[model samples]
Structures are given as C-alpha cells and as structure tokens.
Target chain A: MSELSTAAAVFISIGVAFDLIGGLGLIRLPDIYNRLQAATKCVTLGTCFILIGVLIQFGFTSIGVKAILCLAFILMTSPTAAHAISKGSHDFGIKLWEGSVVDKLAEDKSKE
Target chain B: MMKKMLFHFLMLFGVWLLFTWTLEIPDVIAGVIVSLILAVLLNSIFDGEVTSLLNPVKLFWAIIYIPVFFYHMMVANLDVAYRVLNPGLPIKPGIVKVKTKLKSDLGKTTLANSITLTPGTLTVDIKGEYLYIHWINVLSDNVEEATKEIVDKFEKYIVRFYG
Candidate 1:
C-alpha cells in the first residue's frame, strides 16, 4: 500500500475510536450534563480527526481548508451549544441524581 | 475605507482558496474579484462599513482569550466524564437565578454560554438582569457562590471581548 493510503487508514481508525469512546460516555455517564460533555467534546474532536484524514487522502486544497474550518467551528461551538440545550433543560426543572454531594446554587438562593 | 474592504475581500479569498484546490493565477484573481463583490454586497446590506478589522487591540486580545477557553473546556469535559461514569447518580441538580450586574446584551449572552460550557451547569434563561442556571453538582449548596463562579470565569471574559 502507498504511504498516503496508510495515513488515511490511521486517521480513520483514530476517528472511529474517539466516536466509540463518546458513545460509551453517553451510555455510561449518569446525568444530562455529563452526557452532553461527552457528546460534544469527544464527538467533535473525533469527527475533526476523521475529516483531517479525509483531507489528507484527497489532495483537494479547498476541501482540506473547508474541513479545517469545520473543525475550528466545531471546537468553538459544540460545547457552547450543548451547554445551552442542557441549561434550557435544567431551567425547565430536571431532577438530579440522588447521590449528588452538593447543591450550592440551591443553598445560596435560600440566604438571598 | 478601501483598505478595510480589501482586507474583508482577502479573508473571503482565503476561504475561496480552501474551496478550490488550485493556486493558479486565474483562480487567485477570480477569488479576489468574487470576494470583493461579496464584501461590497454585505456592506450595503448592513448599511455601514464592516470594521471589525479596524480594532487591532480587540483582535489581539481575542487571540489571547481563545486558548484560555480551550483549556477550561478540556478540564470541564474530563470532570463531566468522571461524574457520568461514576456508577451512582452523583449529581445534585437544580435551577437557580443568578443576579448579574453585566449590562450589555453581549455580556449576558457570554455569561450564559460560559455557564453552559462548564461540566455541571447550564444557563436556562436570561430574564432582564437575572441569569437562571441549572447546575449538576452545585458544589457547596450555595446558589450565590455557584452563580458567581459562572459569571466570574466565563461572563467576565465575554463582556471584555464583545461588550
């Protein structure tokens, strides 16, 4: 196999591994916030690596640049977006896990 | 005025280069012309000259702020990952309204986004000057301190950047 194809295979495999880790995080994590954390960070990073691989294999300059831009966009936006959705869910009043150790927000509100 | 337009065009040209794989003269020239037209059209629609490029100081600070944010995001992700996989439901979730002194709309929005990005918290609503956040752990069972942490770390930076 050519060096280029080998590089492509490596990147694709790394991306797939990240995606799997993210999926595992979603299933294994306990709450909404935790789940989103995994989904946004792991998935976004994983996809970026995968796309970067594709960009390398295909020497289309425009595609590579666009993919890099996409990676940047995801890095910046995904966590914030997930945060927004989770916050919205929380504001609507979701229950926390019973094993929770702190409720600082709740305590401070009472004093005020 | 012309230089500002030229820079905007250049940025677009860079974008165009990413779209087309060639670095030939014809492609470069075409990219420049198309980008300039786009800039002109955008300027007209916005009813003013776009001048984000005019502020060198703000631009410089943005470069500094981005890396700090990335580090914080990574740490938050790890924290959340541990909690989610912790077997027991260890989250103490609740919604609390945080009264913030940040006056600008950008400040409020930044505060909201920052809170949301952290591992255990979410920004639910911004009603007037109040920020409602839903936190997963709540740290100390103290709402005010919890809210303060959100405002201090994320909102403060955003206010400085966009406000």
Candidate 2:
C-alpha cells in the first residue's frame, strides 16, 4: 500500500534473486575458482542491494546510516577476502578445469 | 603523511557523525578525539604517503564511476544468471595474466577490486604490473586481448583517481 514498502520489496526480491543465481553458479561451475567467482559476485552485490532497500525503507534515520555503513563495509571487505581466497587456493595447488586454456601464473612461476 | 592522516581523521569523523546523528557537544568531542587517535595510530601503520583522493576532478569522476560500476554489476549478474539457467552451463574459466599501466599500489588495488566486483572475473594475484585473473568466460588467450576485456573500462576511470 505504501511507496517505501513497495520499493523495499522490489529491492529485496532482486537481491534474493541474485543470491539464488549465485548459489546456482556455485553448483554449476566446474571448479573451486569458478565457485568462488559466483559466491563473491552474488553475495556481495545481493547483500548490497538488500542494504540499499533498507536505506530506502529508512531514509536518513539512524538505521539508514547504519545500512550505508554496512554497504560500505561489505564493499571494502568482500573482494579483499575473495582475492585472498582465490590466491590461497591457487597457491595450494588446486588444478584448473581441463578446458582452461591459459595460466600466466604457472608460466611466470616456471620462468622464475 | 600529515595530510593523509588528516584525511583519515576527517573520514572517521564523518562516519562517527553518521553513526551518531545527534548534535550533542559530548558526542562531538568524543568523536573528534577518537577519530584523531585512530587516524594517527592507523596512519603510521603504513610507511609512507596515502593516495590523497582529494582532487575535485577525481571526486567528480568517482561519482560518475558509481553508475558505470553498477551497470557493469548488473550486466555481470545477468550474465551469470543466464549461465546458471542454461543446461549447457557454458563457462571457459582460466587464469590469464594481464598488465596494468597504473603506477601506484592503490591504483593497482582499485583495478583488482573492480575486476573482482564485476562478475565472471576474479583477480587471483598481482605480480609486478601483471594481474592473474580467474575468468569465467575466457574470450581470448592473448594477454593484450584479455586485458582489453578485463581492465580497459575500469583502468580508464581508475587512472584518474589513483594512478
């Protein structure tokens, strides 16, 4: 019945949709690296959208500002963690998909 | 070094203000004091200067960068959705090294973060000027070509801010 509610609903739904697709990506993708790609993109962006919805729902209030802070925090933390995860996995010797065509990391490592 | 610390102080104070929206004198005093202490404490953790992202032009472009980044995020999400929905699940994931022309460490971090934010590509590692990226869809094997796909749009805007 209200504009704020409707907007929040829309945002939450889209966010959940993204989250679901990300889960699907985790199962469908072939390897750990690909699974990470899905998890990072889906969860970060999905959660951000949900936070944006909360922002719209509670504009300029204490909670709204908290929502903004949460968004910023997620933006800062998630990708750094992903970078670390992917690097650690690669360094730990997880093999890429058989179809994978190029690996500049191994090439450089061998050259070194 | 002093300027970067000041910048950090201002940022922390701004966040404090956001968290504590009321204008009481005690809160203001405490926020400023806390911000100063943390700024000095944290700023010294780094050996040298900060990026000093204070330029007006850079600020303007940063604001503009928001929409473009969101658009890329949406496109990437939809792309992933499509891949997931498809029965074939077409994906050609790989690690391709791409070179970035940015000179600063912050610039490099920004570029890598941007790549990771966009779906289908995750930056795995950085060695010197090269980035090892996990690409969900490897469109090309050539380094320059892959760099064009992964780094071009972001590097163009990020160069103005950090590099």
Candidate 3:
C-alpha cells in the first residue's frame, strides 16, 4: 500500500478506537450527564479524525472538500447539541451521579 | 443596510460555492437562490455585520483560534480517555457558576460552545453574565477562580472576534 493510504488507515483505526471508547464510557458512567461527556467528546473527536483521514486520502478533490465541510459541521453542531442535552436533562430533573459534588443550577433555582 | 446585506450575500455565496464545488449553470443558479435566502435570514438574526466575525481582524483571530481549540480538544480527549480507562473512575463531576464579562450574544454563545467543546467541561447554562459549567473535575468552587480557569482560555479570542 502507498504511504498516503497507510496514513489514512492509521487515522481511521484510531478514530474507530475512540468511537469504541466513547461507547464503553456510556455503559461505565453512572449518570446521564457523565454519559454525555463521553459521547460528545470522544465520538466527535473520533469522527473528526476519521474525516481528516478521508481528507488525507482524497486531497483537495471534491470528496475531500466535502469531507472538510462535514468535519466543520460536526465540530460546530455536536458540542452545542450536547450542551442542550445536558441542560435540558438537568432542567427535566435527571439526577446526578451519587458521587457528584455540586449543582449550581439547582442552587440558583432555589435562590430565586 | 443594503450594502451589509450584499456583503453577507457574497460571503454566503462563497461558502455555497465551496460546498457545491461546481460551476455548472444549474448549481450556480441554485446556489444563488439558497445563499440569498440564507444571507437574508442570518442578517435578520444578527441585525448587523454578523457580529464582527466578518471583520478582517476578528477573522484573523478566528483563524488563530481554530488551531488552539484543536489542541485543547486533543488534550481533553486524552484526559477523557484516562478518566474512562482508570480503575478508580476518577471524576469529580459538578456544576460551577463562572462569570464572563462579554456582553455580545455572539461572544457569549461562542464562549459557551467553547467550554462545551473542551474536555472535562461542558457548559450547562448561561444566565446573565454567568455560565454554569459541568466540570468533570471541580478544582475550584469560587466563581472568580473557576471563571479564570474555564473562561480565560477562549474568551479573549471570542471577545475580539465578536466585538
């Protein structure tokens, strides 16, 4: 195999590993918020790496440019989606893990 | 107002061009229609030159910020990996309120998203000038201290970009 495809293969494998780790985190984490932390961070980074691998393989061709666009869209949107989920879940009364330390939002609500 | 609208139209057109990557007459026509609609809708939302993002200086800062953000992301990913894999399951999860001085909506949104994107921290809510952050490790409970740790890294560039 050529060096470029080899590099791409390496990146793709690492990305897949990260995605798997994120899935594991969901099962191991004790609460919804913690699970979100895993799914959002790991999976988004993993997907980006995969897209970057695609970019490396395709260069600046049409497909590569499309991959760049996909990367940008995922990078921008996923974190915001996670934020909304975290906030919405908290507001909807999803409980934090037993070991968690604080709840500033609930505290603020109580003050008001 | 018309000139500003035109400016946004051109900017969106450039993005549309990039996304489509074709000079065929049909696609170009569709790109024009879509970009026109998008630019107008976005203009209505921002009510100005898209929150100083279109400014050359701020654009330069945004360019600089992308690499810095990616670096933080890498560190955050590694941090998450270690926490997830660690036998002890080391996470001190909590929500802490941190203050931000930015007044612009765009700036605050960018800051909130930046906090969320960074590993070990997710922005839970923003009320007034304060952001409630869900941190994996609660190193500080003091508002000023937490703000310093969380907001200081990205706020400068965001402020410059949105000013």
Which candidate would rank higher by DockQ, 1 or 2? Answer: 2
TM-score of 3: 0.93
Q: What is the interface RMSD of each candidate, in Å?
A: 4.0, 1.2, 0.9
**Alpha carbon deviation, residue B105, candidate 3 (Å):** 0.8
For model 3, residues A30-67, the per-residue Cα lDDT tens digits are: 88888888889999999999999998998898889999
Clashes of each: 11, 0, 0
Q: Candidate 3, A11: how far from true, in Å?
A: 1.6
lDDT of 1: 0.66
Give all candidates' CA lDDT scores: 0.66, 0.86, 0.87
Give candidate 2's TM-score.
0.94
What CAPRI grade goes to candidate 1? acceptable
lDDT of 2 by residue, B1-163 (tens): 7778888898889999998988899999999999999998888676433445587888888788889998998888778778777999788878888989998888898789889989689999998998999898888878899889889999999888776
Which residues of candidate 3, in runs, are more than 4 Å off? A1-4, B41-43, B49-51
Q: DockQ order of candidates, best first?
A: 2, 3, 1
Per-prediction DockQ comes to: 0.34, 0.78, 0.77
Give the CA lDDT, 0 to 100, for residue B153 in model 3: 89
DockQ of 2: 0.78
lDDT of 2: 0.86
Off by over 4 Å in 1: A1-18, A28-34, A48-64, A76-112, B1-10, B43-53, B99-111, B140-143
Q: Which stretches of model 2 miss by more than 4 angstroms?
A: A1-4, B47-51
**The candidate that achieves the highest lDDT relative to the unseen native structure:** 3
